[model samples]
Target: MGLPMPGDSLGDALAHAATLLLEASSVDDTLDAIVRSAAASVPGADHVGVTLAHADGRMEALAATSDLARELAAVQESIGEGPCTFDPDTAGIVHVPDLWHDERWPAFAEVAAQRGIRSKIGVRLYGDSASQAGLSIYSARPNGLDEESVQIADVFAAQAALAMGKARVIDELHDGLRTRQRIGIALGILMHRYSMSEERAFAFLTRASSHGNVKLRDVAAGVVADFVAGLEQPGGG
Candidate 1:
């Protein structure tokens, strides 16, 4: 979808963004689309970045529209302080009207200013038990982003989060299907080799997985590999 025109209502703009983001085919594509749409829609957003923060304190930049945006995210990750590094549960949106004068994150602000970023806004995207996300908008002029910009960004953040969550669910479903297929192949191999029933083959796989302290999928994969190896032996087939 294209950027919203002048005098367009916030609802209309967000609806368009949601439609564009939901059309993304993968998690990476969803993230890229979110950043690109944000740059086009959020006011004074010269650069945009999406950051994921894990409960274990790891921060990563998932997508960025420019090198400057990526650099700022890296600085936050290195210093362990910045709008993108804040606790999503306890903090509200962060707005830096002038990075040079902002004191909340001196190290981050210093680095941002050095990179020619004068203003910034950070909005929480989504938060769950294990991880959360933040959207960072950067501008080249002081006071470039105002309250209205924050309001606009908040809407975009919600749309981006929804898109990301949906993409993750899709990935999980695809992974589940692959795991089941691999396990089925392994079970077939075991049933054929030992003349065992399906239940007995599954139990055998379970025992091997527990004894080896390996995941069931990994254990199943090993069984399939062994069967293939035996087939390749001299006069084995």
Candidate 2:
């Protein structure tokens, strides 16, 4: 999808963005598309980046539309203090009309000014209690983003959050399915070889997992591999 026309409504622009996100195939792809949409929807936004809070409390840029946006994100991560670093749930929307003189983030502001980013706006995206995230828009001109722009950005950020949340859920579901499949295959092997009941085979696998301090799935995988190796041995089977 492309940017809205001059007379197009912000709501319409946001709808288009949601469509693009829905068509995305993965988490990375969804984030990349959202950042691009932010640049298009927000007035005077020359660059955009998506910041993600990891489960470990580390923050990093997930995707950016330009090198400048990526560089700025890295700078903020290094300093550990910037609009993007703030918890969106509490801080709300953060708008810096003039980064060149913003006292709240002196070090970051100074460095950002050198890169021609005179203004910035960070809108919080959706995240769970374990993590948080936001979208950061960069502009080269002071007072580049106005109230209307900020409002539109909020809408875009919300849509991006929904898309990211769904993508993550899908990823988790796929991972869970694969883990179950591996464990089931290993259980079958154990049952066939040992003439044990399914419950007994599962119990054996669980004990092995606890004894080795490994995950149940990993233990299952190891059992399957060993069985395959035995079948391939000379004068074996």
Candidate 3:
């Protein structure tokens, strides 16, 4: 019933966690694994969560190991500041030895103190991507995130970033495959109805997409939908 812990060796832990990420069935599952790994493996981590900043500037923490972690992340999102707000792309790493006494993020520190969190650690994940994210761990005791803990958290964050990258790549591949399938079906429809060659059909779809200022995939989808609709019409093929 308990989650797996990281191995004694950091490399081994990273490899095992990477394998799990690759095997994750969905993006949610991969994120869940990252949080769980942090909570179980990282020293001084009583709870773990992930804060994701979308390209549209929306921030959210949908993957967390406990309610406390989720609440803390929500507070940061609402206030627009916290350990997870660190720009991993530029700032690299951040370690908060005592949130209750940390003056840098007063609003967040107040909220965290009220929630019984005394210390925290955040390592940016996928910092170079359009969607910035970080892995955060919270503790109820002051000075919990020491140097060793910070090092461990760094390794954990690195592994998490790798997993997130793999998950996104897999999602993009699936989307690409689906788009290709739709385009192929639309091409088939155009060829059968208009007696057009494959090259001509694709060109026509491209021209339509350019003229309409729409994505080729969307244009192809519309063609497929129209073809299907025609089939449902009375005395129509």
Candidate 4:
């Protein structure tokens, strides 16, 4: 009925953050809330960072406002490992008081330190049940984030993990649908080009996928693309 009294205390702030996490309806919204809450929970935090990794270990930044933070995020992505790529054995609260001294991510730390980022705190966004999300807060001030900030991040991580999981599921389904659509289109092209039945075209694509050690949809798409491109050549239909 009433907001908790405005205070900087960790307990109060965590309660507020927990409430925010509970209210999130989507992964993007949950991440927005998490970042806002991270900045709120910390003492000198000026910005918050969020990232999601593809199945290929390519990390993509979800949200970051500052230019330097965005660049640093891109660097981590290019390297494929950084503070966000922490050991699963880590119990909780992976804290880096100073990026310069953190040897674990030597390249990432060098790049980040040069970018004027002094500290970072990363919490595992996904637990043992799922793997895709990762949360990290980047700070420009030296040794900025405190213990309370880590706890707040961890709590937010757990609460929003459900939404993150849902997003992953939805994303997978969308990708599958797209793959099927592409495969079907490619199969149709093959059928027309080869004067073969749909069933036979599909079988050819499947056999090619298995023989080439490539995905079925990929093989189909490549075949169709090549066939179409041939038709575009001189004296071709």
TM-score of each: 0.87, 0.84, 0.82, 0.62
Per-model lDDT: 0.86, 0.84, 0.81, 0.71
126: Cα error in model 4, Å? 2.3
lDDT score at residue 221, model 2, on the 0-100 scale: 91
Q: Which regions of candidate 4 are displaced past 4 Å?
A: 1-43, 51-63, 70-85, 95-119, 127-133, 140-148
Could you tell me the TM-score of candidate 2? 0.84
Candidate 2 ranges beyond 4 A from true positions: 1-8, 54-57, 87-90, 127-130, 192-195, 224-237
* Model 3 lDDT on a 0 to 1 scale: 0.81
lDDT of 1 by residue, 66-150 (tens): 9888888788888988888847465658899999888889998888888889999988887777777889899999999988899
lDDT of 2 by residue, 6-60 (tens): 4567778777878998888789889988888888778889999988765554777
lDDT of 3 by residue, 43-104 (tens): 77899988876654567886998988888877877887777763535576778899877888
Q: Which ranges in model 3 have alpha carbons more than 4 Å from their true place?
A: 6-16, 54-57, 86-90, 129-131, 228-237
Provide the lDDT at 159 for model 2.
Answer: 79
Error of 1 at 194 (Å): 3.2
The window of 10 residues in a row where model 4 has the poorest summed lDDT is 1-10
> Residue 95 lDDT in model 1?
90
Q: Which candidate has the highest TM-score of all?
A: 1
How much does candidate 3 score in TM-score?
0.82
State residue 237's C-alpha deviation in candidate 4, in Å: 3.3
Candidate order (TM-score):
1, 2, 3, 4
